[model samples]
Target: MKTIYALLGASLLSACSVPLIQPNATQAVASHYGTSAPQGGAALDVNWWSRMGDAQLTQLLALARTNSPDLRSAAASVMAARAQSGQTGANLYPSLTGSASATISDSPTTPRSDSNTALVDSKWELDIFGKVQNAAKADTARAGAEELAYAGSYVSLAAEVADGYVGYRACRLAQAEYQNALASQQDTVTATGSLVDAGLSASADLSLARANVANAEISVTNQRADCKVAAQSLARIVGVSQSEIDAVISKGGGLPKTKPFQVASVPADMLRQRPDVLEAEKRFAAALLDMKVAEAQLFPSLTLNGSITASDPRSWSFGPALSLPILDGGASRAGVRLANANALTAAESYRAATLTAVSEVEGALTRLAAARSNLASAQSLVANYQAYFDTVDRDWKVGAASLLDREEARRQLQSARITRISQSEAVLVQWIALYKAIGGGWVAPKVVISKDLAPKKIEG
Candidate 1:
């Protein structure tokens, strides 16, 4: 009918008048991160720990990449998202289905007759309002998000390994200090006991010395236990058994001297490079496409349907099926509103994620700076205490000082060394934090928008 043709023409014109999803959705990122960052570095390396030149760390990171359950799950998620995107994309095209039936009938005076009927049904929606295309675009956006999420997971795993290893090595350093203190206390206890035997010292003094020895022993035991716990945690991260972890710890030799890394100059520079930021952006894009898809539902849909039957006399039917949804209890409008709300939420989330990334980098830089200062102070104190201990030893040799004075000086020196060791680990952990916040040099992949779903004029 001319009326039907005119209506179709009008629908096509209106549906093609505007794109369902604007191109700005994907690029609608925050202009800048609301904070500052350090400067003076090239882009971070993908294998960031390699810069530390620690062979053991590199090996452990490789092991984690191969065996981390979290990474495996993230990888699986990427695959699922990829498949879903592909499936949604396939829906935008026409499809044909083939079916066949066999039937037999018998009359009272005739033999049974049999025939086979085969039918082919072909159907496809024209997508005049970009409904299917927008849906596919949304799925593709989700796929991109999943891919970036995988990269984020990779960066996080490396940070976890670094955290565990740093703790383990720091524990070892503390344990060694505790052992030295324990030995020194034992010597004090022995010498004090001898003084008591010679009537030069009271039994109470010997008792106090022995008490110090006991306390030192307890500290040494606790420190060793803590080291073991840290080592076991590192082993779990490396996907190995505790004994294997012990081996790695042995291979570590001792607490490492970590190299400080400079952060990106601007917050946006780092946030844009971060995989989580990209993931959030993709999610926002997907949400915007979802809103477009929902709004597209408010328009009429044109479908082409065709069928053919295989028989003694073949038959076929082909026609256009128009679906004009006049009213469905305002569900379409509600759906569009819900989708818009979700898009708004996703946009906010993207902004928040970017801000959080900036905070992480800034916080780590601040902590690292403080740790460096504290370590410098501790090193200075250690040197000064060692000098004092040397003077005390010389005085004690000439009978100008008691053994207790020399012991006190030695304890001060060891305490400073212990403090330096702890600060060293803090600095290393901060570097790891910064590395993770900036996505550890992961190159984010380009977002793959479905070509079929991209905004285009409807071909009516």
Candidate 2:
């Protein structure tokens, strides 16, 4: 008994010797992006998609949130993590269970008799070694990590829906432009045909008009196909049927308008807003706690475990139980090494995440700036070409310009319009990229623990 008590005391001491995790290489990398950096924005609302000022986009995002399988999977993960944390925490206190039983016996010389018994059994491995505490801490950290992961999923989904909506609108705008060009080409073909019938136009002129009409028809066909594909993709993202998508398409809307918002901030703010970065950090913390748990195993553990059993002829008594690791073939040492290595790896991952996040933000900023410049240039070209085309049209109506000259001016106007639309689409795509780089508005996880297992004082 004395030996057992001594062993238990030694084990308890060893278990309590959980080591502290020093900052590792990964932590150094994370520091480059800065931790808990102050961002110049309000707490991101759940309705972040509404900020884009597109009613259709808002509706699609809502549909995704309601029906997306990925979001549902993420929510399930959060629930699982919460349950696991609670289970681990339960080990921190005594476990009490009750049992009742009845037995019947028959003897050769005596009548049969029945005996009934009921008892409440309680057992607890006192956490003097901090093993249970470390386990609980690790579980808690993991739960937090899972929660961040869920939030990251939601943010990703929102970004995807928004981008798909924008792409769909752009495709529609392209189709509209192509349709107008096709109509202009048809008109040109008709005019050329009338001139040929009147013997005022050459066969070569009719041939050129026929070629323009065919080219316009091809362009329209391609645009329509692209628009159809875009609409289908958008429908898939929002978890709707193709028929529903077609219905939405039947109700026409103009191209998405751009807001004049300036991104005049450093990359660090964007890194801080990213949900992936937060998830990585939480995972890092969990790894650190696991390492601490592994190190704590190298020490002895003390447990006050006892059981009471009563027989038919007597009562029962109990005493403390202790355990110590005398020899385990370096298992504890190996555990410590493995845990430390994992911690190092986790740290590296954190650093990599931070670096990647910063890079994305910087790249998006550069692209957005370039896109804005290109858009301005394209707008100016479109305006100039529009004025020139209008002057040529007036001159042609007054018999001061040749039909060929009018056709050339119309071609230039169409080219300018197409270029402007392309630039506008590029600008919108860049803006979406910038928003994604800025982390799509994630908040920290909220933790709650039950108070049902409050420890009771045991009087001597």
Candidate 3:
């Protein structure tokens, strides 16, 4: 008993010093994005999409999270991976089984004979070299990676939902703009026709006015069609029927107000924020453990097997079993090579994902800044053109300006308004892109335990 206790204590002491295989390559990332802006200490929102202040958007996001088939599929994948991890964890513990049997024989000239046997057996593959331990940890890492995958899906879903909502709203606003222009152009056509009939305007001028009215009608038709498509897209994303989406959109007024864009940090923060990058890290970690498992297979293994029976003459046995690799040809060597290559692949994948994340953040930031600047300039231009149109309209009412001058000013004002609307939508799209680039508010796995990833004593 004393020797056993002493060995247990020694095992406990040495467990802390056990070594593990991990990703060896260092990740050197820049401190700031290429397009650095004003930095704040605010952390990214976990529910960033909801900050748009549109209640319907919030509701749609909630419904999509609950009802979307993509999320459901991802959830199922996580469950399956966790179940597999549990199965692998069983290798860390001893397995016990029992068997019972009864047999009887009878013949015409021989007396009947019966025998009964019952036995309880147990087998434990001692984790001296951490083969089972490494395998268990590898499975744990895989399960964690699957969880991260689910988070990535969630981020993508929310981004798409926001995009559809923004587009639908833009289309609605554009349709309104076209309707206003159509009203104005139709009035111009009526006034021009009256002037042509009175010999006050040329027939060519009246024809041009009619053409403008026709073009205005076509613009309204195209705008309405775009709105329908955007609505359908939102419906598909919400996993609801078109009618339901229509009802939801009917209550929606405009794009949710978002606080002006700011980031706490760039590349440094993205490494922790990006779900895909963290997922790649988990995969690489799992692959490294797999390589360790394969390397351990090259060594001998120790197992404890015990059996006891209850019968007329009771019997029991207990002993240690050892398995040594003998002549497996080149399979074991090839397995090691394969594992090594897979680990290398995982490492490269992680690196590539990191680089991609960096590039996306930089590009999104640049586009966002440009879009904002363009929208500001567009709004200013709209203001100036609208003032010019109002002045010409006043001048025409007093017969101080030609009807052609008023019409030209009106067209310029409408065109400027259209451009401003387009720039506004562009800014919103860029905002979504930036949100997605920053990892969509995903948190990495915090605390997880694999049965064992290092050499440890197996309980007897």
Candidate 4:
């Protein structure tokens, strides 16, 4: 017993003697987003899609939140990770098991005999070298990473729904413009036919006018088809019926107008909002803990086991079991090397994710700025063309302009209107991209281990 006590004391001392080889790498990032916008504006809302002020869009996003298969899978992954963490944590505490058995025997030489026994057994591993503790911490960190991944899925789903709605609305707006152009062309064709019948215009002019009307009609038909396809695509994302999607979007709302929100000026501050970046960091932290577990494996392990049996007379036994690495070749050392290499890889991955997060934010900011500028120019172009078309139409009615000139002016006006519509949607799509690039205002959850073994987030 004294020798066992001496071995336990030596094992405890050796636990502290294991050398730690933790290698954590920090990455440098840009200071700003390369924008002049001031930092002080309304903070981004968690439900950023609501800022679009479109009820139909909000409804679609709500449906996607509840019905998206990606989210369901992510939620299941989080549950599995949490369960694994709890399982790992269980090793930190003592375990108890109970068993009962009964036997009856009849022999010619010894008459009849009956025996019954109930046994209680327990085992506790003493984590003197931090192996079990580090393993539990590693699994807990992995659980935290999975939770972040679920949040990432949530942000991605919202972005997808918002982008789909915007696409459908943009297609509808184009269809409307094409229909208006078709009506105008048909009227021109009717006027040209009258002139041809009066022998005042060439029949070739009438033929060209009829052809223009036919082309315009085809344009309208094609635009309508495109709009239907866009709506169907949206329906698939929101997991709703096509008729329901058509009913909601057919209410004739043009492109959604978004309420502007300011982005954080500092890149590091903004990166905190990104779930992928945080998830990568959590994985790195978990890898570091795993390396510690491997390092602890090089030391001795100590476990206490006890058992009690109730039979003809009650009996109990208790003892400490020490397992020293007498000769396992180099498996434990190889494990340590493998874990250290994984930790290094995780650190590099975290750095790469950080760089990607910053680049996405910067790219979104650049595109949004350019879209806003282009939309302004497109609006001016449409206004100027509309004025020219109106002047030409009045002159043609007064016999001061040819029908050909008025028709050309009208075509130019229609083209300008289409450009404006496309640019308008471009601006809105860029806004959605910006929102997603900034993580849609998802805050990193602070995981708090609760009594029920469920991962809970602490309220800020």
Write down the RMSD of all candidates, one decimal each: 6.5, 6.9, 7.9, 3.9
lDDT of each: 0.76, 0.71, 0.79, 0.83
Best by lDDT: 4
Candidate 3 Cα errors over 4 Å, as ranges:
1-24, 40-43, 100-117, 310-313, 391-409, 445-460
lDDT, candidate 4, 1-460, per-residue tens = 7976776566446445444456666889877778654344478867567766799988887777666677667777888899999999999999999889889999889989888789989999999879999999999999989989888887888888888888888888888888988888888888878878988777987788888889998999999998888888888887778888888887758888866788888899888999999999999999999988987887888899999885533589999988875446667777778898899999999999998888888888888889989999999999999999999999986668887898799889988988998898888888888888889888776544334333344446
Better by lDDT, candidate 4 or 1:
4
lDDT of 1 by residue, 241-314 (tens): 77766665678556555655556565667767888888999899899889889878878888999998866335
- Displacement of residue 364 (Cα, Å) in model 1 is 1.6
- Show model 4 residue runs off by greater than 4 Å: 1-22, 38-41, 104-113, 395-405, 445-459
Instruction: Give per-residue CA lDDT, model 3, range 1-460, as digits (tens).
Output: 6865565554444333323334454567888777865454245666566566788888888777766778777777777788899999998999999899999999999999998888889999999888899999999999989878877887898889988888888788878989999999899888878877988777887778888889899999998999999989888888888998888889967656654546656587767888888899999999999987887776667899998896633588999976665446656656767788888889989988888888888898899889989999999999999999999988875657777898799889888988888889888888788878887766654322223211111222
Order the candidates by lDDT, highest first — what do you get? 4, 3, 1, 2
- Which pairs of residues clash in candidate 2, taking residues 3 or more apart in a chain or in different chains? 11-300, 11-301, 12-300, 12-301, 12-302, 14-299, 14-300, 16-129, 26-347, 274-439
- Separate clash counts for every candidate: 0, 10, 0, 0
Ranking by TM-score: 4, 1, 3, 2
Can you give the TM-score per candidate against the true fold? 0.85, 0.82, 0.84, 0.88
Candidate 2, residues 171-278: lDDT per residue as tens digits?
Answer: 777788889988987887887788778887677777887888898899999988998888888777777788876776566575566644433255555566677787
Clashing pairs in 4: none
Q: Pick the candidate with the highest TM-score.
A: 4
**How does candidate 3 score on lDDT?**
0.79
What lDDT is obtained when candidate 1 is compared to the true structure? Answer: 0.76
